[model samples]
Target: MLSLQLIRDKKEFVAERLSIKNFDAANLLNEITALDKTRRATQSELDELLSKANQLTKSIGQLYKAGARDKAEAAKSRSAELKEQTKVLSAKLSETVELLNKKLVELPNIPHESVPAGHSDADNETVYEEGEMPTLPEDALPHWELATKYQIIDFDLGSKVTGAGFPFYRGQGARLQRALINFFLDEAIDAGYLEYQPPLLINEDSGFGTGQLPDKEGQMYFANEDNLYLIPTAEVPITNIYRNVILKETDFPIKNVAYSNCFRREAGSYGKDVRGLNRLHQFDKVEIVQIEHPDNSYATLETMKEYVANLLRKLELPFRILRLCGGDLSFTSALTFDFETYSGAQKRWLEVSSVSNFESYQANRMKLRFKDKNGKMQLAHTLNGSALALPRIVASLLENNQTPEGIKIPKALQRYTGFDLIK
Candidate 1:
């Protein structure tokens, strides 16, 4: 969605930035630029022909009025020739524009200056840690095993009824899930995020508005019968509410929070990491989205990090924050921070949230612009984060708070759960 003019002006800079993501943007930029030039040239030529045709028509009308029927007829033939030329040029312009747009969709967002260069999660840097990693009892087992003994989560039933990675919560496990969702939503509201109940399915425009189409299409469940796709995240529907909208400067920073059950295909994923509540085809999450002035977006990123960190603190779980490397970053995010909680029984850290600043990348695609103080329209910055994801958070809480008597509920959610312990 980058303006070709912007690409023309900052080609080298953008190329260098994308290099961090191992993306060579130079060739694509050149191709886009050439296509733009070709489209523009075709348009200009077509406009000239139309202008000539209009003039000829006017002359023909005057000739007809003057009883010069032969002259009028000659001009009509010339106009027909011009019309055919316009048609050909119009088709070429359309074809070139389409190709250029396809290339634009393939390009990832330019990395921010501070982003570290690397590929994959292995390159991500640990930027912060909170609380001590707790030692588990010698007999501690992973959350999946504990759920079996406690008769809380019924994975086999979920598989039989639906599919893998969709576990049915039973007894206190269901209560805990509901409690965490309520707690997270309440926290988000306290932070000034207006709650939104967005739809769980979206049309094609909604998907493209959030950059989910043209690339991640296979990662979503397509309901071809209705021409809709099941939402992969709340951000898709919630943020797309502003698509094609023009706002006054004061309308930002627009903040919204929503909870949704996300559906993902996870087409090629499997194995150990997909175990238990790790990777799932369906999961619950509370999401926060913000629209801000471009100048303040990076600053807002820090505030978001603190907000999610506070959430983990309220739950009394050990967590750490990692700055995603270029390779590990999402296609549209310029920068990202992921939070992971230590699962004592599992003897590992489980990712619970990821906060990202998309800068103007998404805004451009959405056509979400705001008038600056001077009344000039500009792209707004967009950011979103998972305040908390259910499965892993449930995993971490169940494993970390386990005791022989029962599972201890975090003090913050005790009232919501209606009990301090689940025996």
Candidate 2:
């Protein structure tokens, strides 16, 4: 949620920036301003009426003490009328506030000034590219084919047990998945992030706190009976840990990491791209979240981006980083850098991680604040990224590292996997 005060002070500026996100803010902003004005006016009237009522009560007491019963009765009657008026004004104020909040939540976070103006991913700017594209033999198979050849991942078996997009990882595939999770978690801990094992199920407020409620409603799996949502990412649960919290200046750089089984209802998704380990209903991801002082948030973003890049580098995979154009950026992020790894068989870059600086967007919604050196409480900046999502990373690893002998595991992950190759 945006700060109403910021909107009031910079309506035009805010509206203009929102345009970069492809949001039409003119009508919404106008309605919010009108509603806010009515709410404030109603509140002011209620305050004045209450003040008058207090004065009338004082006069009534004085008159009654002096034995002027008639004057006291008249003041009492006026005070009763003021009470009724306040009741009506209070209802109006509540209605206006509700309407104002509805419109406010509809507005997405404004794009940062550095964000490129574009319509889609095609227009995203390539900020960095590293490693080298692996040279594979023409006979090299896609990850799915390789999985079947090695009897690693069984999609048909999974469908029989559950449904599509719920493939069963067998033997080495399952072990490799576990290995990746542990490796990512260990990397995060080494980077000074406190690891958390947050509940996989969250309430509605927790969903809304991370800006995943109304915006991505259809994309989440809800347990209707309990009204709890299966987390779409560890980011949702881990970041909400600080919801409604106020921190001191000394807690400037709060970092946390979690590995979770993310569930998503990819409602309209279809086609070849969702093949193999590309997309799934449930997947494992290691998420890194940070709450930083506003002054240091961007620096923190750089550190995070480097951390993710280093992970890919250690895996010896070819990768590139894209500075997401406004239209391609997530709703809660002001600026985002997406890391994509090349899948040799697919001949395309697969997004393995997205590091973003929400710049108080999520913090504002979560009510996560900090007291700065000047003694003023302000929204802290919140950021999160996939230290790496396993499925796609596995897909790239299999495709890019494929050899005539078998699928070779990267040296960095060999110790965790217990074996060097899935032959």
Candidate 3:
């Protein structure tokens, strides 16, 4: 959420910047301003009425002491009228404030100045690319076909047990999944992140704290009875750990990580894009989150981007990093860079991670703040990235490393998998 003060002081400036995200903020700002005015006016009137009531009560006491019973009764009646007026004003004030907040939350974060104006992923700027796309024989199979040939993943069984978009990994495929989780977690630990095992289900406040609720409600699985949500990423629960927390300046670089089973309602998704491991209802991912001082958060974002890039390098996957265009950016991210790995068999790039600097967008919402050297409290910056999401990474690995003999595991993951190749 944006600071209400910012909208009041720089409504025009905020509106101008939000245009990069293709958001029209003018009308909403006007409504919020009018509501705020009404709220303040009502509060002021209530305060005045309360003050008058207090003064009248004091005068009423003095009037009774002086034996002026009539004056005391008149003052008492006036005080009763003031009380009723205050009750009505207080209710109006509460209603106005509630409506104002709803409008404020509806506004998406402003795009970073460097963010390019565009409508879709096609317009995203590719900042870097690495590794070599594998050469495959004419008969090379997609990961789904390869899975069947090797008896690794069972899509039909998953459908029978649950529904589409859920797949059961068996034998070597299951081992590969476990190995990747451990590998990603270990890598994150070595890089100075504190690892956590967070709950797969999160409360509505946790969802809203990380900017997931209301905006992406349709994309998330909800346990309506409990009013809790299945996490779409470990980032949701992990970043929320610091919600409503206050820290000292020395806590500038707070690093944390988690590995979790993510669940998403991929509604309206279909076609080849959702084929195989391309998209799923349930997936495993390792997420890294950092809370940093505003001054250093952008630099921290670059460090995080490279951290994910290094993971792709270690996995020997051909990948590229694209700076997300405004329209393609998430509601919570000020800036984002998506890491896409090449799927050799599918002959396309699949997004495997998104490294983002949310700046104070999430911090403001979470009330995750730190006291600076001047002893003033300020909203800290929040950043998070998928070190790697398994489905697509597994997809790229199996498809790109296919041989006539078997699928070769990357050397970095060999120790964890306990096997070099999946036959």
lDDT of 1 by residue, 26-74 (tens): 8888888888788888889888888998999899999999999999999
Residue runs of model 3 more than 4 Å from their true location after superposition: 54-77
Candidate 1 Cα errors over 4 Å, as ranges: 58-72
- In order, candidate lDDTs are 0.91, 0.92, 0.93
Question: What C-alpha lDDT, on a 0 to 100 scale, does residue 314 get in candidate 2?
Answer: 92
Most accurate candidate by TM-score: 1
Model 3 whole-model lDDT (C-alpha atoms): 0.93
TM-score of 1: 0.97
lDDT of 2 by residue, 62-181 (tens): 999999999889888888999899888888888888888888888899888999988899999999999988898888899999999999999899889988888999999999999999
- Model 1 Cα displacement at 213 (Å)? 0.9
The C-alpha TM-scores of every prediction are 0.97, 0.96, 0.95
